[model samples]
Target: MSDLLARHRAVMPNWLALYYDEPIEIVSGKGNRVVDASGKSYLDFFAGILTNMIGYDVPEVREAVERQLATGVVHTSTLYLMRGQIELAEKIARLSGIPDAKVFFTNSGTEANETALLLATYARRSDQVLAMRQSYHGRSFGAVGVTSNRAWKNSSLSPLNVHFLHGADRHLTPFRGMSDADYVAACVEDLRHVLSTVVGGDVATLIAEPIQGVGGFTMPPDGLFAAYREVLDAEGVLFISDEVQTGWGRTGSAFFGIQNHGVTPDMMTFAKGLGNGFAVGGVVARGDLMDGLHAVGLSTFGGNPVSMAAANATLDYVLDHDLQANAARTGALIVDGLREAAPRLPIVGDVRGKGLMFALDLVDPATGAPAPALAARFMEETRKAGLLAGKGGLYGNVLRMAPPLTLTVEEAAEGLGIIVDALETVNAEVTS
Candidate 1:
């Protein structure tokens, strides 16, 4: 074992997972590439699970944070008036698409979702919630309960009466082969049935990832949430779009992934890319729902000035530079390349994603079943080829890629070449 791995294992919890058979210790990064402790550089395809929205060592983001650092006061608590926080919130509110949208900052996506839950439950006055099957909101106590992915649920107990909904994981579902319209219809029907029977009384809200992030980039058909929103609207259940991974123009087609479906969520929680690696997460909600939380509480680190500065700069960069259009154009190159190569590569069962976010379902070619072992081997091969990627899925058999939005066409080609080579190498080893 590597010395660092041995040290990590001795101190860290065994359940805290690490990627790769021999994990590479990243030491530094710039643009879309990172260098390991051993001084080996790699094309960072995952971009820290889509958190580095723009890129690493970004001058704009760095300068903003540096300017805040020079101010000497970083944490003033949410009790005081903060210019940075309010300005960032204003930008987010305008872009949120929710009329009279109010912003609440948190330290992470999990907290943002939790705060949204608190407001939602209080507003609707119920503990019942509708969560998507194969979803992963976060790892916190409240988050774990609503996470429908079995692997992510460490605890047997939950605070909310969570009812799992179908249609998120299209590949695993019986309706996998269904057309987009049919799949959307089936999912909508499931939502209607659950609301009418399972909950019985009022459901606080239906929280869902716009594109199920930790669930292996599982994407439901367009208009899926639109139908869900329609059903929930009639029942007075709020719709919360968890845009932790799919926010910040990452989806290419829209600012938030829910926008693609033509539905503006009652509440939208975002984090990952918004801060561009600074700790920033928040929820934008309708005025009534946001103000409905009766308890007097404050998040000490929720709106740290430094973080707010980073987020403001990041958002400004994203908007001024038009990263959304960039995501769409660049993401297409990777998606098209992967789709084109899927037929030639035997282990590749499916290529699914939109914009900068997408995934490759690795499987046993003969059986067409999820091949977790093969996925592991494929990751190792990519590491050897100096391409850092991501792995996830309900079955742990998918290779996910959400590179920085600023990935150049040439960089995309280079990454694709490395990916194809790695896949080929892994395929040969398995089939041999």
Candidate 2:
């Protein structure tokens, strides 16, 4: 092992996962590329796990952070008024479509979701929560409780009682061959069954990601949540859209992934990409629900001026550049390119995602079983080709790609070509 690798192993916990057989430490980045400690450069297709929204070394964000630091008033706690915090909250509250919305800032997506769950349970007077299978929320105890993916969930010790419901993974579901209408109806019926038989009644809330990020960019049929929203409305259950990965126009089709489903959530939690790499996250909820936190509550570092400044600048950059439209256009090119190439590759099980987020699921050519080994080989080959990608899914066989929303058509083509080459190299090695 390298000296840095040895040092990292000694300092970090064993459960802390790192990518690749030999991990390279990233020293710096610009746009879609990052340079490692050894001066090697790689195209960053995963965009720091979809957190680097506008891309690396964004000038506006950098300047904003520098300006905040120059002020020398980074930490004033939530007790005192912070102009940056109030201004950022105003923007978020206005963007959040919920009527009479209010925003509560947090340090990360985990805290944001934790706060969302608290508001949900308190407002609805139920500790029970509904989540989707193959879903991942976060690593916190409260976040893990709702997480259904076994790979990431640490323990069963949780404050809230959680139930897992069927999320739309059409390829892996029994309804894969069914028509869209039929499949949605089936999932809705399953949800109804769970609500009635399992929970015995309405739960506090139903939380979901518009597109499953760590679950390999999994998507449900259109209007899936809208149907669920009808049930939630009837039962007076809150709908919490986990936009941690799907927010901020990354979905290309809409500003928020929930918009694709034709329903507005009662509450929405966001984190990734909002700060463009800064640790910024928050929840926007209806005024009544946000006010349900009866006792005194405040986050010490939730709305720090520095993070707020970074987020404000990042948001401004995203809007000024119209990166959302770019994401949609370039994402379409990448997906279409992969689909065209998929026919020749027997190991490719599926290519699915929205906007800039996508996944290429690998499987055994003969048996159609998830081919984790093949995915691993492809990942290594992609690294060799000067590309950085991510892998996820319950089986760990899905190659994930979520480049920055500002990705150009040429950059998308380059990444797609590298992926195609890597896939071919792995296929040849395995088939030989």
Candidate 3:
């Protein structure tokens, strides 16, 4: 482990964070569990940052990838027609919920957001964009520029004229004590104020995550985006849903997280789970905006046949098994379990999530302050107990939980019990 970590530090960026005091090197995964280099196994509650929507070692997805690999051509480069790519695009366009949607594929969520920004700016003939606070879009120059999460922003430079808004963080301040209806009203008013007074002119778009991922599964009330969308539409500003973490039924009740709001975004950017680990991502937008951008000579390796095959097969399994329903059922069971136990665990300051995506807001029990140290201890405890979780947030005190949508009820119970035990262990250690 030391040698591997030394090698990693030698080559990788210093800013990239790894979990645990001694990072576990995951060598292989199957179902919802992964094996470390030392042969210890962990039940993965984080799904590799929620990328593996289905699970690991899925036979259908693997066979599809193998079939595509056997085709003898790997780099079609979008210069030629490929049936898999075409079919996958059609499926995404239909699933996107944007009317007369057109699709463009990319290799990751960062590229997907970049494409969305380009399209929004080109269509509106403006560089101005609005993003959610306590949110993370991506790590690229433009994505980081639009992101409001300070921990992820390395530089102030950007290609777009960006503005930050009170998005999911309405749960944070100023609007905190208000009722749900009034909170939405307050945020809508905030949007109006920003557009009318702060932004220069003719804002291109507003991009947001239905639920903030790297910002620690933070989410707004049900109708927050719908309220914002009304104001944006009135001002000719397009709304883009960054579904990098919430897409493809991870949220349980809806096919896309945006659907939960009773509205549709003008454009949607997706990644993280579409290929179920095969590196596929994309944007779906209204035909007029997409055609207006032209986006000629877009990507060299985006939507390669191999990725499409994997994504198509992965999607098919999700649909065939009705994993959305499974996520809903199992997610509720786990969340209910957590809430029931939260009262006993004072370290759990807050328990929040939708479907499979959720967070345990760890806090100092004595002072009610964000406690990164306690969060770290809890994570280590969970690891020791054979569970792997994710962590992040503005204060780095939130523990993220997002198992595969394919999680079964029994698995959920096991993970929940492990979490309870970990919290108890950490609580005793801290109190002692």
lDDT of 2 by residue, 1-432 (tens): 499999999999999889999999999999889999889899899988999988899888999999999989878889999998888888888877889999999999999999999999998788999998888889999999999888998798999989887765677658678888888898899988888887855489999988988888888888999998998788898999999999989989998899999888999999989999999999999999999777999999998899999999998888888888988999999999899999999999999878899999999988889999999999899998999999998899999989988888998999999999999888777677
Q: What TM-score does each of the candidates earn? A: 0.98, 0.98, 0.98
1-432: candidate 3 lDDT, tens digit per residue: 999999999999987889999998999999999999999999899988889889999999999999888988777888888899889889888888789999989999999999999999998999999998887889999999988878888899999888888867654668777888998888888889998898888999999999888888888888888888888888999999999889888889898998889879988999888898889889999998888855366588898889999999988898899888888899999889889999988788889888998889888888878999989998999999899999998899999999999998889999999998988888887767
Candidate 2: give the clashing pairs: none
Candidate 2 is scored at a TM of: 0.98
> For model 2, what is the error of residue 137's alpha carbon versus the real structure, in angstroms, after optimal superposition?
0.5
Candidate 3: list runs displaced more than 4 Å: 171-173
Relative to the true structure, how large is the alpha-carbon lDDT of every model? 0.89, 0.90, 0.89
The TM-score measured for candidate 1 stands at 0.98
In candidate 2, stretches whose alpha carbon ends up further than 4 angstroms from where it belongs are none
Candidate 3's error at 46, in angstroms? 0.9
Error of 3 at 61 (Å): 0.5
Clash number for candidate 2: 0
